[model samples]
Target: MINRKILARVAGVGAAATVAMGLFSTGAANADTFVPLPGGEIVKTLSDGTVVTVRLVGESANINPSLGSTPVHRNAWVSGSAQVELSGTGADSGGRIFPGYTVGCQVNIAGGGTSGGVDGGVAWEDGSPSIGASGGGDLSLGPGQAQSFYILDLEQADDFGSETHKKRNVFSGSNGSVTWADSTIGLSGCGGYAQARAFVSVEVETESVVTWITLYGQPFSIG
Candidate 1:
């Protein structure tokens, strides 16, 4: 009778251990809930009556947790592709008009606070290690500000044509992957949450007219 009671207790402990392991597995699966960002598309009509459509597709990010910490640091890799299509009566006829424009995409990371004891972190290019920049200045966010970094830029100047009629050129490109790393004083403060976003810009030019349009993508967390 003593031996049988001991065996029963051991079996009960084993069953409880199995249930605990199963719960831990379920929690871990739920923690990795970051999904792909939704792509964006927009159409705009320029002053010259030209209609341009811009699409941002295949957007994704890989976020890694802090790598231990004195100054806590986190990393992320972002990638996506963009395309521009031109169609309108005002498009230059028989000439390469689209190639004269400039197309680009930028990523923005923002978080933290200043006076409220919140710590706004700084982000830099992953491999190149350059601090982000915008409007010809260093990019850093404090409280409500955001810093923008270029993902890709393409110029269509070499594709110009001599045709006197309406010219249309379609521009499309991909930003394979750009890595970004963020550093904070420590992760224990009020400004712990960080987000990443993407945007596309286009500059359209004619001999006498110029127009600009920009589209923004949804924001995703990096933590």
Candidate 2:
């Protein structure tokens, strides 16, 4: 659950900008920074006349710059909500929501603009870690590097009744939404300034087209 007391003290930005929510002294060298992010939204009209809208809301993060007693380690707790709405004749089977984040070390991950832009700036050139995504944020990185991970790992029975895991949520009708709170984003091995951002990738199916649309959130500093 999000602490409404802290949330009330801060207002939603509604735009992508570096924020400093609060500064609380935890120790002589370990001060925590809470960031209230202004999530974003995008709306597009497909060729088939179907309109799709994706939004990232209620986003925030708490950062601890030196988690491992060294300059190379950092930790953060993040939360947000992704909402998708479809209109017009399409939306046959609703959509799929894949919410994830990308962390970078001395790299650029900012999009061209706030909303309606699809580029997320994720893929690494070399040496990436397999996060299993499943809500695990522990990562080892070097300068000029970055990685991506999904936040959900849902368990469900397959057709044969075998348990399986999924990284996305599927919705029916014309609306789909997912909310996550206090997800961890851990990093190490980069003694320089680091940054992270959130993305909402949704696949909506219609009578004439099946397309994937991504909504980019504001990139913020991790340390």
TM-score winner: 2
Off by over 4 Å in 2: 1-30, 112-121, 124-135
Tens-digit lDDT string for candidate 1 (1-223): 0101110000000000000000000011112243466756667665556666655667555555343342223344455554555556434421111111011112133121111111222332211112234322112233343344443222234546533422222222211111112212111111344445555444455444455444445556544
In model 1, which regions exceed 4 Å deviation? 1-34, 68-71, 90-143, 153-191
lDDT tens digits, residue span 156-180, model 2: 9999999998777777777768888
Candidate 1 similarity to native, TM-score: 0.48
Error in Å for residue 134 of model 1: 7.3
TM-score of each: 0.48, 0.77
Cα miss at 185, model 1 (Å)? 18
Q: Worst ten-residue run, lDDT, model 1?
A: 12-21
